[model samples]
Each structure stands twice: as C-alpha cells, then as structure tokens.
Target: MTGYDDKPWLAAYPPGRPPHLRRAFSTALDMFDAAVRSAPDAAAIHYFDRSLRWAEVDRAAEAVASLLIARGFAPGDRLALCLQNNPAFVVGLVAAWKAGGTAVSLSPMSTEADLARSFAAFTPSALLVLDDLYVDRIRPILDTGDTGVAVVVTTSGLDGQTEDDPRIFADVDRRRPADTVDLAALVDAHLPGPGVLAALAQRRVGPSDVAVLAATSGTTGPAKGAQLTHANLAFSAQVYLDWSGLAPGEPVLGLAPVFHVTGLVGGVCLAMIAASPLVLTHRFEPAVIAAAAARRRPVFCAAVITAYIALADSPDVDAADLASLRLRYSGGAPIDPDVADRLEERLGGYIHNIYGQTETTSPSHAVPPGTRAPIDPDSGVLSVGVPVFDTVVRVIDDDGADLPVGEIGELVTTGPQVIPGYWHDPVATADAFIGGALRTGDVGFMDADGWFYVVDRKKDQINAAGYKVWPSEVERLLAGHPDVEEAAVIGIPDEYRGETVKAFVVPRPGSTLDVDAVIAYCRANLTAYKYPREVEMVAALPRTATGKVLRRALR
Candidate 1:
C-alpha cells in the first residue's frame, strides 16, 4: 500500500502498479519508438505554426541526428536547448538523442547571467537556440565567461522553409568551415524510407545512451546536471502516465514552459508517457488557452495554480460548461483553499491538486481519481495524496529516526522514483540523504490514515513574540472563513518580537470584510500569538506561475 496505515477509509496503494520498473529508464530515447508505434498520424504534437504526426516528428529528429554527425559531434557531448516553448524545442531534444548527445534544457526566460551560469556549469559543446528568445543576451556572457560553446545552431525556419535571402538558419558549425549547413535540407535528405539507411548510418546513435542532461541547484548550492539516463526518463514517464489513469491516446494540453521539470515531464515526457497527443499553448497565454478550450477541447491538462486563477477570473471562463476536458490538475505550489473552492463551484470538478518538486521529475502526488472532497475544504484536500505508482514516503526527525503516526517532522522519501543524489555534489547529496532516503526540506506529518499534510518549508517557520507559528496553518484558518476570498501570511520584522505575523487578505465578493472581524475569527481558531498582529486588505496576492503564494514578495 502506498501510504495506508490502519485506516478505515483510504485503502492501500492501487493494485495496477506493482513495485516494479524502479529506476527503469536507462534512457528516454524509447518514447520516440513508442510514439511512432502507437499512432503514426495521431496528431502527435501541435505547436507554433506547425502540427506534426508521430512519423513526421521522427523524421525531423533523424535529420537532426545526421546534422550532428556531419559536424563530428560526439556521443557524450552536451547540447544546450535555450529556446522558448516551440516545436523546435522537441525537435532539438529528440534530434540530440538521435545523434547520441545529451540535451541540456535552459529556461527561455532566464537572464544572461543565469543562462551563462547554467552553460558554464554543464559546459555543453553546442547550443540549439530559438530566434524568438533574446539569444543575443546570453551570447556576450558566453564570450566573456568560461566553457565557450563550439557550435551555435538556429532552429527557426526549419518547417520545410527556405527563402532566397537564406539568412535564416545559416548553421554556425565550427567543424565545417565556410558556411553552416542547412538543417531543413539535412532533414529532407533523411526522410524515413529507403533513403533512411544512409542517414541512420551517419548518426550511428541508439538507446542505452544518455539523452538529456538535467541540471538543478543541487543541495550543496551550485548547479549540477543529474545525467538522467534514457531509462530514468522512460521510467518517470511510465510512472506519471499510470498516476493519471488517462487513456493511452487521449489529448493532453501543454500550457506551461518547456524549461522546468513541470513542463518537460508534464508537457513533454508525460504526453509521450502513453504516446498521448498533445495540444500546446506554448507561452501560457490566458486568451489563447480559452480559445483552445473553446475549439479543440483537449481531454486532459497539467497546469499550475496561477493559470487556474487567471482563467477563473477571465471574462471567458465558463466553469459551468468547460469543453473537451477530462481532468484539470494544478501543482508547483500550494493551492489556496478559497481559490480551490471557487474553482470547484465554477467548473464543477475541474480542479485537482498535484504535489511535487523538480527532484521527483514531475508530480509524485495527486488527488485520487474519484476523490469527493469539496473545494471549501481545500487545505484539507491539498494534503499530499497516496504515494505515487512506485514511490515510498517516511517522516523522520533530525537524528534520522522515523516518527510514528501523526507526528510532525521533515518529510523524507525513498523509492525508485526519488533520485538518490544530485550531479557532481557528493557532499550535498550526503547531507540530503539519510539511510537512503532524500530529505525533502519540507516540514510535514502523516496522519494515522496515511494522508500527508505539508506543514510548510522548514525555513519559512515564524517565531512571533516567542511563540512558534506556521504561515500555512494561519492562512488555512483564514481561508476557511466564509467572508475571506484569499489569504497569505508572512513574517514581518519587529523590533521587540524579532518577527511578527502579518496577514494579507482578499475579501470575497459581496462581503464587507473588516480587520477586526478577521482578527476576531483568527483569535477563535488560532492561539493568541498565531493570530495576525497586522492585517492588510488587497485586490490580489502575488503568485508564481503555479499559483504558489509569493510570501517573500509581500511587504
């Protein structure tokens, strides 16, 4: 059983998923075969100005492989993909794999400094950049910094396109002196038929090799690449697919960025998990999403809380009758109780809570498929659900001892789904893992029923006037009130107390909410020190892409 204690209601882990296929994928290259096998023309991927079937996508990837071979790119060499959410992103990634190199995904929105920092950390030999993003911003940083990349390739104008000017996509291969090779021509030459044997021979790549280079701020501090084997990614994809229980060929929406784990796994890996067709709203535009929903009606979507909030408030949002939707899930941050309730009220059963971090690849927790919890009980619902398909959970103390039922402690996880360590940082990895379990750096406790509750980030705890207060607790209490629409609690600096609790609230529509009443309500639910000493009413609370309340931003 995933998290089942001796509880009466929630039972053991689902039976379909056994404790098999752990640390499974040695590489991610298998998804391409799976995609091609499942549906050659299943509307495999839809993105900017183009839609590709499985067969077409594979051909393009093979072309990318040939181009790398022509430049003498090696097997273990790294390739940085510094592009926004576009079809080229997938082509570059898959192509890098076909060519036997690792693709390092870079956030398109990252500043030049961050981009340079990332590039230097991995020392990718080449980069595939999008024309839309400010690629020039990172160029100066690369020239002045360490780890100078050898090759620069433009992905623009690759969709069967070529102009007389030919200025677009003039590949800058240092190995090939004179002019860069045309990528489109390379791909056209490799069209998957009798002529394909020649192209495949040139690239000479296959499975059992690393496909993606995953980098994150490792536990110790500096950025390090995880070296995700193709098997690891394939295993993660399989685990996520089972977690959702969606049909194999269902249409899923990709409305998030491709840079982060959320987008890569949810938007890319998960779509290929079961070879599902994907509908992409690349840049996450609210109007475009509404338009897509009105027209295409994708069956499933993996999104964050910010998108939910925006859509909920949009003039076009008609929760009563959403089109082409099987499930709507939000993660990346805690979902406010009030927001959750309103979404349920509007969209019927549109909102579900997913919980995970970059470490888990993507989501390791989600509401049960048929959960009947109400939105009014949001925090009660956000409690991380049962362990994922092949994951394990444990709550422990500083001495590395496991705590009993209902005891609060640092959440530690151990399972095939959890990465044992970060890239190139043994010290950080040692500090993070205890007895083979990764310490999540989150404060939480599991009830006897096996439901896990996230208390807060251990670092975010506040000491107000010598009393310990958790913002999640206070905010949860505030959100439960009928008049409160939304609430965010943070620590405000105090001369005498060191740090005082401050509550920023948004009142519900058609309610005259006052501070005295709110403070009085908190006083009834929380201890004296836990009550907000200062309350400020605002139009809205600041949030991240996934709807996580940006408590650090509140002044």
Candidate 2:
C-alpha cells in the first residue's frame, strides 16, 4: 500500500547505475549545438554511401531556417512536414526549432482527404513535402483551399545521395511541382550568406516553448495535436542516451520513422545528444537493415515488434550482423515474450520493452538494459518494466484514489518529459490530465517490486502496425457509404501486428454490398494503417438498451 514515491524499482537497477539524470541541457536545440561544437568533424548522419558531418548539418539547418523566415514563417508558427526516414526529415525538424517555430509531423502514407483534415485543423503556415508525393497528395489538398499554408517546399528523396545508390529519384526539372521550389536549390541559393548565419544567431528558443506538435488519436475520433515543449524533448533524449550507455561519435542505427515519437526522440534526438552517427534507411526492409548492420555494426537500435520479427526471419541476417548490438528497444506495440526470447537468442542481446504515449514524448517505462522482465504469477502477464529517471507511476481507481498492488486500474504518470496539454483543445486537455499527471487510458497494475504490467486497454483504440486507430473514426467513414446503413469497428488479435482493425457493417435493405467495396471505400479516405483489413457483412449491428452499438459484443 506504499506510494510509488518510495521508488522500489531502484533496487532492480544494474550495479552502479545512477538513480537519476541531471538533464544538463535546457532545450533540444541547445543539445544539438553542443554536439556540433564538441565534434565538428565527426559524422552526424549516414545514408546510402554518403555521410554528413556535424559541421555540415549545422550549416544546412541554419540555411533552412533562413529560408523559412524569408518565406514569412515567424516565430511560434506551425510548419507541417510529410516525409519518411531520411536526411530531409532531420534537416527540416532542426530548422523549424532553430527558427523558434513548432514542427508538425504528418504521415507520408496519408491520403488527400486525410492530409486535408489535418491541415485544416492545425492551420500550418508552411509545408515541406516529399517531391514525388506533392503531385498526388499535396496538390489536391492545396486545390481545395482548405489549409492556411501559403509557402510550400518540395524536397527530393535522392538529395545528397551517392551516385552508386540503387533507389530511383525523380528528375527535379520534369516532375517537380510548378508552384513549389526545390529544397536543395533553396538551400544552395541561401547558404553561406550573411543573412543566414545572422538569422540563426538572432532567433532564440526557450526551454518552455513548444518545439513539436505530434498528432495522436483519441477516443472522440479525429487526431489531436500533443504540444511537446523543448524541455520535454531534451529530457527524454538524455534519459535514453544515458540508458543506452553509448559514447560520443559511436554508431547507432535509425530504422524507425522520424515522424513518430519513438524514432524522433530515440533515433534522431538521442543521436544528437550523444554526438553519434545515425545510420538512416528510407523504409524498414529486412535486407537493407541487415546490410546496414553488416556494414556499420551499430551498437543500438529501436523498432516495433514486427520489424524485429522480419529481421529475425530474413535469410540475410546472421550472428555477425548483430554481434555488435548491445541493446535493442521495442515500443508502440506489445512484444510477445516468446518472440523477445527468440530475437535475443539470435542477436545475443536483450530486447527491452518501452511503454509510453505520444503525449509522454517517447518512454516513461523501460526495462533496464541487460535485465529480463518477470512474469506475474497470477495474471501470467509480462511486466513492461519500471519507470525511468525522474518518472512516477501509479494505478488509480474511478475516484482517483491509489489502488493497491496487483489491482487493475488506470495508469497515471508525472515527469518532466510529459507534455503540458493538447494543442488548442482545452476540453481534451482537462479530461485527460488531472492535477499535473497524465491519465493514460491504459488499464494496468504495479507489483510490490515496483514493476508495471499492462492488463488491458481502457480506450477503444486499435494498435494496427504500431499505429493507434480509433474505431469511431473508421465508423464515421464507413457510415458515409450509400450502401451501408450502420457500422461498428473493433480490434481483433493479430500475430504480426498486436491487433488488426476489423469492421462489422450492416448493409442497406435489398442493397448488395460486399466486403471488398466497404474496404475500398475506407481505403480511399483513411490512412494505410487505419483502414479495416477485414469486413463482416451482417443483417444488423448489435445494439444496447440505449440503442448504442455494443463494441464489446462485436469484439
């Protein structure tokens, strides 16, 4: 019955591990500048057959900041970016922060309608989209005149790529959008100029200022923006950097997408904090990750469970490619214990499980490196692990009272890394956060040993391929079809993804609507991960006493 302030997990720390982190840096930009000054000539970023040193990255970020300012993006403005894991993503992220603006990350897989919804909600002043995606994705949204964006910058996936690389990049002249300017050409047009360096020095970002606006779904339906401050990003990065035990100029693998919080904090921000070189890949292909591991021999990497499964199942991976791996991290989705055991056997390293939300900025609970998690005797659930430095976790009941150990209840957390509130959504912010602690909608309990285990999810959200998919959002889209009378969506257990989206639809009387047509209609409006892969046609949807669809019964 003791409070978590006792920090019982400190007893489980590896020998000589510090109890907490000092968190020396004030902001993410400050950390980045310190890394550049400490190792100007050291490699900071690595792509196919090419590398960018710390000095080069700093100069490029400065030039991009100047371009943003000249394009009418003032301090505290929102800059939307739609890109994958590449050099351009990092460049744009740092540039926006340097210009004292908040960066908004959008999924590259989002359809035109999906993009339009987000753009209208956030009302970003500027946009940075991939060159090839601009034509099919951005142009349609811009034509509607819904977004407030006035300036658009298109970046090539092949910029700074080696000539020997295998991927095909579009020719800038023939395929480039007529209204947008090339990112590389803009940088070349502005860099090494007097104004660029002066602007970089003049703009000042504070620790409490909002640095990033990450999009996340709630139970209500559409995605809401989580306003993360500079201190939130800085502390999260420093916490993991100390946890990984990597040194300056070390090699780290960046396989996760930079847009997500895990990759943004663990992959990019952690590398900057440690002054390490991040080996980048455009997407998660087993062969490419295997080849990069063989060449770079990275010391650490983070990804979802499916990615680890793909690498372990691939024929190209072997002991040599993973020999240098000291620690591995898995987040966004739950990892089966058997899968973790098998992957550890292959890589000779423990795969730690991290638990957090987009609102937490990345991780709040993580298994200490080199240690294995214990299984609960009664529930048979594997513990996610103990809280990291300066974090407190408690299980609360319906009345906000602390529950005893082994009791299932809502998980609440408080720490420096937690975001203050949701962007422009006071109702959601007030509903989710209570007394400075985030009321995480996860039903879990803590053990006497201070370890935490997730028993179930309180929110009716689906984790498909490590992305949160709200059932209500899909139901709204499904109800729009003429042939559909009513719809209900639920998550079904999946082996590869933790869960897959499944829809139960009621066809209009005397109207013929198959599963294919329903899925196609959803695919045209929703993002790739949010679409329902399996559809069931029923005579009518099950209703409750009040005439509401019973999602639990459908499940």
TM-score of 2: 0.82
Tell me model 1's lDDT, rounded to 2 decimals.
0.67
- TM-score per candidate: 0.82, 0.82
lDDT of 2 by residue, 467-502 (tens): 977675677567668888668899999888889999
RMSD per candidate (Å) reads 5.8, 10.0
Clashes of each: 11, 0
User: In candidate 1, what are the lDDT values of residues 1-555, reduced to their tens digit?
Assistant: 323333322353455545445443345666766778768887677653356788887878777766666677787777788865666677788878777788898866666777777876777877777543424565566557477576666654344222212222345221321223334555667645555446555543444455566665332244566555565567677766666677788777776666666777777877776677677654665656666566555677777777777777777667533566767777776666667778777665657676666666666666666563223233353565656655667777778677886677887776554554665668777877666666877777776556666778776789887887888888878878898888988888999889988899999998999988888899887878888889999989875433456676785
Which residue ranges in model 2 land beyond 4 Å of their true spot?
163-174, 217-220, 460-555
Q: lDDT for each of the candidates?
A: 0.67, 0.80
